[model samples]
Structure formats: structure tokens, C-alpha cells
Target: MSMKTRTVKVGPVMMGGGWPVSIQTMWKSPLAAFSGPGDPSLLAAADEIRRLAALGCDVLRFAVPDETGADSLGALAAASPIPLVADIHFDWRLALRCMDYPIAKIRVNPGNIGARWKVAEVVAKAKDKGVSLRIGVNAGSLPEDLRGMEDRAAACVAAAEREVAAFEELGFQDVVVSMKMNEPGEVERANRLFAAKYDYPLHLGVTEAGPLIAGIARNTAALVPLLKDGIGATIRVSLSDSMESEVIAGREIVACAGIKKAGVRIVSCPRCGRDSFDTHAFLARWSGRLYALKDTLEVAIMGCVVNGPGEARHADIGITGAGDFVLIFIKGEIARRAPLEEADKAFAEELDRLLG
Candidate 1:
């Protein structure tokens, strides 16, 4: 099927156009991270976001829960080097306040924010202020009217439709929709249903998806199909981990699905009998060194030479273990062989060279 296309403007960023799904992370800094509500933690968050941007994160979101947090927006926006999305809930005034800032996007569940006019006001403000709006619908936080429904997906889909309809009615086409469920299948089905019904840009995520490893796997399983089907415009790997980890995981997910052209791709065997090295230890070392290459290089870390180089010949750089030493392959040819002890450093140096 030819994917239905929709374009949305978020601050200065334009999403959709079959744009490679952008990676996003919500900043978890407590108010303590700021001196107070309006206190500018711009430097602190910007520092973290700089690392994220270097790691190839396309968008960063911060929770604007109160007046103080809302006030921080302008400073953060002025200082931030990357696009920023403001997450607002509970108060329409907060969203209204966010409109005054230089945020690239605003994410709010239309259900919780009071009245139809309130939503219209928010949408209008975003439209007037040139900031994009994300109508985020979550299963865990479904409207009270939708609670205890016989079918939760139906309830979520209905809620999402209503929200989308609101935006459509407002003549606000610069909108993206998200229906997040904790379960992988639920999110998968919900987005599928939404994609079939609506032409709006979609932001896909499985909310509250647990800690690091589990969360990444669940987000991947849910997002991969929809993404491959040309269903989503942006993606967020919502890990209960650090923002850096979330960006890394999101990039990896898109890369693994063969959708994202940038970012590192490390392919190591799950450690079978043919393996001769400490596969687990090797991956640990490799993952750290990977930070330097970060979002720019794709390296395959394979356990055995048998299927290693051939399976990963497409990779920019890769390594295959041969008895005591690992052969480092750049593109398809063997560049050099390094002993296990120096493999991580060698890989890092080689990756830097490749990126240069």
C-alpha cells in the first residue's frame, strides 16, 4: 500500500514525508534538577541533550507540569541546540503558557485538558505560535468515560479518533497522534488501526515499558511492524532508563528495522558453541566504545569468523573472532587483526577513522 502522507510543523522541524523516524526522549529531571520551577536548568539539560544530539537524537521533550516549568521553556529553547518538545498534562493553562516559549512541539492528551474550547485554544495557540501539537492518548490514562470498557483498544481508538477529529475540525493539520499501551500487542494493534483510519503523522511508543532491556525489546516489537508498513513519522523508545540510553535504543531499533540510515549497528551472535571468545564480555566492552561512534557508524560484533564477516559485510565496520584474535573487517575486506585484549580500543580507533 502506498503510505498516506501527512506533514506537520514542529517549531522549525517538519515531520512526515516518510522522514526517517526521529528518536525522542523525555527529560526526567525533577524540579530539583532546576533551582525552582522557572529556574533555568537549561545548562544541565542542554548538556545532557548535547550528548543526546551527538548520539543522533532528533528531539528532546521536557515535562512542563507547572508555571515554573512552563517558564523554563523560553530559556531552554533559546539555549538548546536541538529541537525540544514540551509535555503538558492536567492544565490547559500550562499548554497555553508553553505556547509563549520556543518549543518545537507540545504533547498533551486532549481528554484530560478541560472542554473542547480548551483544546481548540491550545491548538490555536500552537498554530498561531508555530509549534506542533501531538495528541497523545494513553491506555493507562484513558478518559474516565472510556475506563472499564469491554475493549480497551476500542476505547483508545475511539479516544484517539475524537482527538484527531478535533484537530481536523480546527483546521489544524499540523498534528501527530500517539496511542500508547503498555502491552506490545495492544500498541501494535492500536497504531495499526489508527494508521488505517487516519492520514495524520503518527508518533509511536509503548508507554511505561519497564526498565532498560525489557523496555527496549517491547518498544521495538511494537514499533517495527508499523514503521516498516510506513505507518509512523516519529518514534520514541520510552525506557525507564537514562535519556542517553533511550536515544541509543531508539536509534538501534530504527536501524535494526533497516529504516534509519544513520546510527551504529552491532551484530553479535547470541554465543553458540562455535564461539571461542567471551562474547558477553566482548559485547560489554564494545557497547561502551560504541559511544564514540554513537549514531554515525554501524559495527557488527560477531562471535565466530564462520558466518561473521559474510553476514555483516554490509556493515561499515565489523569484527569476527578467529581463535585467539579477532579480525577487524572494514566494509568487506579484513583490515587488520587484533587480539581480544585490544579489540575494544582497536574497534574504537577504527570507527573514529571510518567516521572521519
Candidate 2:
């Protein structure tokens, strides 16, 4: 059981209050083009957001640097199916401006968002708009006074506490806090301390967590322990990679921690001397579409007949190949066989039939 905190509604999804731990990822492209209400590009962006949502992303955040960014995000928020978050820095006006739209949440560093009154103004606006705020405390951007503190984890906890106090003083309680550090240990330690001190929802993440392989490893190290101990309420696996990859990694982490069992899980074999099938190519062609599935299905793609049916006996669907022929297994039993060149089409037909 996860730590229970106050429930904050983000558009259609609910965070905390024992709700499922949600996944968040940032938007990669420039936001200017998305401001147009019904432009082709804007429509395309909406379509992409829908795809992301289908892949188990509960919240999507975009950086709002200026009024233009606010406009762009506002327009997109009007049509976004999932909740949209505005990441604000320095200027408090942009935070104020972003609330004018249907933006679900605002992420701000109270330490960097200037004097108390400025943060107050932003909080007031957010409260009026039913927009919850995320106190995003990053290790690299601690307040000047606390920068010299030797216990960095404690400093992070203090930073989040200050912000939490600020919000509480103003009678605003819809808050989520994240204390992120590049190091997994610090990330876990800081977040653990904060959760012990407060009941606000915590957003778990290891900031600037490197490339794909290393990032996943570092995040898993920090997050799994907190999650298993019932500490985190929502999570973002920050990566130097695509947003889709980030969302998928976040879901996998949550699942691995036994937080939630949801979405499609893809299992594949690493090719070796005995392998005749191209597992990599097969996954490359099918991974995205498979992850987009709403139903929870275990899918296995193996390099040969040996690892195919036996290892994936419980998989709802399995596919593998050996030389001239390809085989498709349904529940560990061979259901279809096709020539090498025709395998993909044959699998697609069976998949469609299975899904239908």
C-alpha cells in the first residue's frame, strides 16, 4: 500500500489519495506552433498527445518561458485529452498567464520564483483556476543561503518544506512536491525525508538521468525503494531520450516496483549463434503499436522456436522465426505458420483478429 496523501484532481486523472501512481513526460518541440486553435500542425500535435496518453502517460508538461509560451500552451490545453502542466521559472507573470487556460498544473521553484509576494500572486491565481502546483526542487538550483549546506538531502527537504509552508500559509493545499538530484541516492534520500515530514503528494524523479540504458538503471535504483515503501504518488523518468521512451520507462519502473500492473509488457530474446529470426527488426516494427494498446497483454518475440513457445508459454501472443518459416503461438500453441517474407502480414492479420 502506498502512502496516502490529499487527492488533487488534474483534469480527468487523480493523483494521491491512494490513486494509481501516474506517469509524466515533457514536450520536446517548441510550443509556438501549437498556439493556433485549429491549424493543421496544432491538430497533429493533439493527435500525438492522444498517442502518448494511450501509452500510459497521465500528465504532460511543457516549459513556459514567456507570454507566447503561455498562449501556445493555453491553446493546446483547450484540446488536450490528458492533463497539461506548465513548467515555470523566474518570471511569475507567465505562471499567472498560464492559469488563464485550462492548464491542469503548474511546476515552479519557489526558491527561484522570486520574493514571497510574487509566489503568492501565482498561488492565488492557481487557486482561483483550480490548478494544483508542483514544488519542483532541483539539487543544482538550491537557494543561495542553503547552497553551502553540507547535508544536501536535508537542504532539499528544507526547500520543499519552505514551499509547502508557503502554500499552506495561503490556504492552498493542492500541492505536489519533487526533490530531484542527479544522483540516485540523493534523490531517494531527499524524497524520503520530505515524505516523512509532509502529507503532500510527491512527484518522484532522478533529474538529468542520462541516456536510455543508464537513465533507466539510475531511476530504478532511486524510485523502486521509495515506491515499494509507499512513498511516491506520481513519477517521471527524466531521460535524454524521446518523450515516448520516457513514458514507457516510467510505466515499466512502476510495474517493476509492484506499484501497478498495467499496459502491455513486451518480452524479447537477445539474438545469438542459434538465432535465425531478427528480433530487433520485429520489435522495431511492432513495439510502438503494441505499447499503445489499452489492454494488458504480455507479448513475446523470440529469435528461434526453442525460446519462443516455451519461455512465453503464458504470453497471450508470441512470434518467432527459424530460416524459411515463421511461427505464431497463441497461448503456447502454434496457431499459424507462414513463409519468411509473409510473416509480418500474417502476424498482423492474427493480431487484428485477436484484438477484435
Candidate 3:
């Protein structure tokens, strides 16, 4: 059962309100690092954003440390193909300045943005510009008053609640909420508590989730249950890696949770002594291109013919190493056979034909 919540539009994308769970990733570097006020670097960043969007990144966020960063992001936002989010901290003025641009969303912690009136000022501008606000609450950044709370998850919920109340009081309700904890258990607890208490869209993620492998593991453990129970509106797999990796992890998590069904699904067997193919290397070379495919198809990369063809017989397409050659199977029938060196090209040709 999908959790029902109010929808918040971020540019052309709609999340929550029974919408499909969307994937988001934060820019790995500061916006200022990308370009100056009027530099070609902005175009480079725009090109990268377009690539990430093709990989299924629904929203892209950048850290706005100061006015200069805000200005840089404003220019990128105008050219970006997907919705952009400005992540602001400490300075309410940055949030206000971000609103002046075409940025789709603003993320700020009410606790760090100074007093209530400062939040009100940002909220007023957000409302005036028709931009949605994401009240991000992290366990490491909880307010001083709430830091001593015995329940860390409860504390996160409280912090988010306080900020949401402030937004409501100002008659600004176009809001999204996120409560993140690095620990999987606490992350689940915090998001669960927030979901039970509020109907606002919940952006789910585990903060500081480490590098690619560990981050994917932690985020999957934390987000799977919540997503399966229909809790999250949007999700970001915060991997300390490339933005492409983060978006890929997010898409896999959503697909694993059964929240999303349209995309290429890759299934490969773990190679053992019975294997003849280098499953790992082949998958590594093709994973990105395979995932980027928009078609709803299952592609299996198996190590050997033993259980490969039988297990994935229902797959639309499959490949397995047999003897010194690779066998390409489509709909349970062998479609083509190619040597090891030509396997990739053979698979690509078959895939293109299937896609066409």
C-alpha cells in the first residue's frame, strides 16, 4: 500500500500524493567550484546534470555556502534539464537569494537559520516565488535544546515538527520534510515517526552513509522497509561517490522496494568455480549503459550455462559463457553465439535490436 501524502511540485516533477518515488542526488562539489558568475563551467555542469537526469535523477541539489555559490547555481538552474534544489545552511539570506533564481526548491534547517523571524523571511520569499521548501533535519545537526533528548529519532522528529509548525504559522505550506540519521536503525525510526505524525511528503535518506558500497548497503537497509510500507515520497542514496553512482543506487533501492517497475532490471549470478565468464568485469562495463536504458526489460548476465539459462528463462534477454564462446539467448532461445572478444559488441547489437 502506497502512503498517501500531499503532493509538492518541483518544477516539472511531482512527488508524493501517490506519485512514483523519485530519485535525487546532491552535487558532489560546491557550486562555486564549478564556475564563476559567467563561466563555461556552468555549461559543463549543465551537461553533467543532463547525463544524471538521463540516468533517472529526478532532482539535483547543490550546497550554497554563500552569495557567490547561490549566483552560480542560479545560472545553472536556468539551463539544467531537471529540477534544481539549493541546499542552504546558517544563512537565511542565501535561501532568500536562491529563491530569486529559477531553482525549484530550497532546503534549510530552521534550527540553524537563526531565529523564527529569519525563517519567516525565507518562508515569505519561498511562498511569494511559489517555490517549495524542504525542512531537512539531521541527527548530527539537531537543535541545542533537543540534543539532550534520550531518543535520537524522536529528537529528529521534534526538530522537523518545529520547523513545519513555523512554516504553517506563516501560511506557507508548500513544504517537504526529511529526517536523516547515519545509523540504519535510527534513520528508519526517525522517518517512521515523522511519517506517522505528518502527511507532508517525506524525502528519505541516510546521511553520511559512507562510500559507494557501504553507503548503498546502509541506505538500502534503512529505506527498504519504509519504502515498502509506502512511507517515502522521494529518496537520495547519499554515497560519497559520483552523482551517477548515487542516482543508480537510489533507482536500485526503489526498484528493490517494488515502488518502481519501469526500467531495465539487471540480474547476474555470483561467479563460482563452475563459472567460465568474468561476470564482474562484464557487469562493470555494461551496468551504467544497461541501467540508463528506459525500456522495461530484464537482462541477465550469468557465469555459466548450468543454472543460467534455466533460472533466467523468463528473462527477455540473457548471456552466459559456454566453453570458449558466449551464448546470447532471447526469450529462452539461443539467438547468437560470439567469441569472448566479441561478446560486448554482440550484446550491444542484440540490445539495440531489442530496444528498437
Off by over 4 Å in 3: 33-38
TM-score of each: 0.86, 0.97, 0.96
Judged by whole-model lDDT over C-alpha atoms, candidate 1 comes out at: 0.79
List model 2 lDDT by residue over 1-356, tens digit each: 45898888888878888988999999987777453577887788899999999999999999998888899889989889999999998999999999989999999987789799999999899888889999999888988888889888889898888888888999999998999988999999998888877888899999999999999999999999999988888999999999999999998999889875567998999988877788899899999999999888888888887777675566888888767778887777788988988878988887887788
Clashing pairs in 1: 37-68, 263-295
Best-fitting candidate, measured by lDDT? 3
Each candidate's clash count = 2, 0, 0
For model 2, give the RMSD to the true fold.
Answer: 1.3
| Residue pairs with backbone overlap in model 2 | none
Give Cα distance to truth, residue 136, candidate 3, Å.
0.2
Tens digit of per-residue lDDT, candidate 1, span 1-356? 11556877665555776656777888887433345434555566667678788776788888887887877765677778888888888898888887787778899987678588888889889878878889899888888898889777788899989888888898887888899988988898988888887888888999999999899989999988877788788888998898878887877777666674655666777878998666688777567447535456566778887878785576778887888888888878788888978877787787777777
After the best TM-score superposition of candidate 2, give how far the Cα of residue 33 lies from its true spot, in angstroms: 4.7
TM-score of 1: 0.86
Using alpha carbons, what is the TM-score of model 3? 0.96
